[model samples]
Target: MSEKNQRAHDLRMYFTGFGLAVTLTALSFLTAILQPFGPVGLFATLAVLAIAQVVVHFRFFLHIDLSRQAREDLQLILFTGLLIAIMVAGTIWILGDLMTRMM
Candidate 1:
């Protein structure tokens, strides 16, 4: 594609991402305020929206796709996700242990 076309495409993608992010954020806040769902359902809905927002951010803003050129970036993100999961799990485990010991 020509330079102009490529620029236009990028601009369109950025706007689309922005719209999606805003919509997701608004829905999350609305869900919290409106309390449309029960406690468990509310959390689940928010979690799903949050994950979708992350995906949109990665695909649009970060330009991290499944293409060969983006493989390294994908690996980095996956590794970061793994480390965060481990840390969260460990913290929860420690807290649970403390609670059990206290009881």
Candidate 2:
């Protein structure tokens, strides 16, 4: 295909991805409005939906895939996840210990 055609195709794909992301975000907001369930249940559902939206945005908008640079991408994602886990765990542990000492 010509360069112009390729650019147009990419633009179309980007718009499609944007539309899907917007739809998912709207749905997530609507789901957040449900009040029949308890706060815990609502919060859990909202959290799950928000995470799903994030993954969708990453996969479609960012065009990240395992098919290309699979190992490197996987390693990067794993390392990032591990770092986040360590940070969160350490913060919680230290805060909990401090709270115990204070009481």
Candidate 3:
């Protein structure tokens, strides 16, 4: 495609991503305020929305994809996610243990 077309395509993708992100966020907040679901269902709904938001960010904002060219980027993101999960879990575990000891 021509340079102009490519730029337009990129801009469209960005706007689409932004719209999806905003929609997902709005849905999350609406769900929280409306309480349409029970406690467990509400948590599940929020979780799904959060995951979809991540996907939009990866696809549009970060331009990460499943193509061979994007494999390295995908790996880097997965590794970072893993590290973050580990750190969060470890912190939670330590806090839980401390709380239990105090009780």
Candidate 4:
């Protein structure tokens, strides 16, 4: 494709990603406020939307696809996510332990 066409294609991808992110955010907030699904249901809905938003951000904004070239980037992202999860879990565990001791 020509440079012009490529640019347009890239622009479209960015716009699409932006739209999806915005929609997901709005839905999450709305779910929280409306609580149509009750507390537990709202939590599940928000979790799903959050995951979808992550995917859209990676695929569109980050330009990371399933292509061979994107594999390394994808792996890096997954590793980072794993590290974050571990840290969060450790923090929660420590906090819980502290709270129990206090009680």
Q: What lDDT does the true structure give each of the candidates?
A: 0.96, 0.79, 0.97, 0.94
> What digit string (tens of lDDT, one per residue) describes model 4 on residues 1-103?
9999999998999999999999999999999988899888988999899999999998999889889998998899999999999999999999999999999
Q: Which candidate comes out best when scored by lDDT?
A: 3
Angstrom error of the Cα, residue 25, model 3: value is 0.9
* TM, every model: 0.91, 0.70, 0.86, 0.87
Report the C-alpha lDDT of model 1 over 4-94, residue by residue, as the tens digit.
9999999999999999999999999999999989899899999999999999999989889999999998999999999999999999999
| Model 3 Cα shift for residue 50 (angstroms) | 1.2
Clashing pairs in 2: none
Each model's backbone clash number: 0, 0, 0, 0
lDDT per residue, candidate 3, 27-97, as tens digits?
99999999999899999999999999999999999999999999998999999999999999999999999
Better of 1 and 2 by lDDT: 1
- List all candidate RMSDs to the true structure: 1.3, 2.8, 1.6, 1.5
Give candidate 3 misplaced runs (Cα > 4 Å). Answer: none
lDDT of candidate 2 over 1-103, digit per residue (tens):
9999999987987787788778877876777676656788778877887777777776677766678666677678779989999999999999999999999
Q: Candidate 1 — worst ten consecutive residues by lDDT sum?
A: 29-38
**How far is 81's C-alpha from truth in model 3 (Å)?**
1.0
Estimate the lDDT of model 4: 0.94
Off by over 4 Å in 1: none
Sort by TM-score, best first: what order?
1, 4, 3, 2
Model 4 per-residue lDDT at 102: 100
